[model samples]
Target: MIKLSGVIITFNEERNIEKCLQSLVNVVDEIVVVDSFSTDNTKRICLKYNVKFIEQKFLGYIEQKNFALGHASNNVIVSLDGDEALSEELQESIITLKSNWQFDGYYCNRFNNFCGQWIKHSDWYPNKKLRVFDKRFAEWKGINPHDEIVLKDHRKAGKLKGDILHWTYQSYSEFNAKTEYFSTIAAQAYFEKGKKAPFYKLIWNPFWAFFKAYFLRLGFLDGNNGYIISKETGKITYLKYKKLRKLYSNN
Candidate 1:
């Protein structure tokens, strides 16, 4: 059987770290947590479990994740965020996969819990993430706030049944706060890549974001939570482009 090493990056994740660690107890042979020196009880909680806790400087999302990957003792890795945990079915599927170890990587659907609601739509459900993989074949890539694992070659990938339960936000205020922070990072990333956002995009892109999430994606099926998500999605779009425009104008 292949031994799996679980890795995660954390910063002030006291509220979610325990749950995240507990879920990995049965699935992974070892757990490694790379924290950005959280001032909260994150380290204390991590000590409760048999985890190798390393305090590192605050690197961007993609960089931090790659750093965490380096601490793993095994090449077969199960990477997760501090706010995410494997569902029971996913744990079982992973356990079985470890016994057989067929594909180079495994992708699983993530179901996000937003403000106490298990969002079924709003482009949230079936949020496919390639979290489990062989470190030799993949690396974390993409923008700051949104990082994904990219395979080095045309490696074989497989899907697993079940979800990665993502405890996204506890309140609307938290959602907004994250949006503000993430939008800033996204704009900076875009600006660095020589991407520009004009006035028309500032106006039309947000409208299209709302329409696509709320209408085309069938977000309405989630009721009030759907509306809030769709609205926030549009707001984030506006913020990203607006910030991008400001960045270019200032230079």
Candidate 2:
């Protein structure tokens, strides 16, 4: 049987870490947490789980995760964010893979919980992420705000059965706050990568962002939460390009 290690990166994730750890208790042989020196109860809670907790400075998403992978004991590493938990079905699927390792990496659907409901539409559901992978075969890449676990080759991959439950936002206000923060990061990353914001990006991109989520992705069917999500997505798109334009004009 292949020994699987679960790795996570955290800052102030005390609220979610316990539940996240609970879900992985039986699925992974070892649990490793690379904490970004949070000045909260996060470290204490991690201690309760007896996970291999290593304090690391907060780098960009890709760097921090790659650093975490170096600390993982097993070849089959399941990387999860502190705010994410494995669903029961996903846990079972990973367990099966532990006994019969078949693929170089496993992609799973991630369902985000916003406010109080599990969002099914809103360009949120089935947010496929490559969370489980063989350390020797894949490396995390992408700009600062976005990171992807690019396998040695995309062909050496497989999909898993269930979703990774993402506890995204506790309130609308918090969601909005994060949206602004993420947009800045995304915009800066784009600018650094020599991506220019055309006039259409500032206007058309936001409209298409909403349209893609609300209509093309059938977000309207998910009801009020869906509309709210789509609207927020539009705002995020606007902010990203606005920031990008600012960077472009300044530089």
Best by lDDT: 1
Candidate 2 has which clashing residue pairs, if any? none
Candidate with top TM-score is 1
Flag regions of model 2 displaced more than 4 Å. Answer: none
Evaluate residue 75 in candidate 2 and report its C-alpha lDDT on the 0 to 100 scale.
92
Positional deviation of 233 in candidate 1, in angstroms?
A: 0.7
Error of 1 at 111 (Å): 0.7
Encode model 2's per-residue lDDT on 191-243: one tens digit a residue: 87899899888899999999999999999988888998999999999999999
Off by over 4 Å in 1: none
What global local distance difference test value does model 1 have? 0.94
**Which tens-of-lDDT digit does each residue in 71-97 have in candidate 1?**
999999999999999999999999998
Go through the candidates in order and give each one's C-alpha lDDT. 0.94, 0.91
Question: 95, model 2: CA deviation in Å?
Answer: 0.7
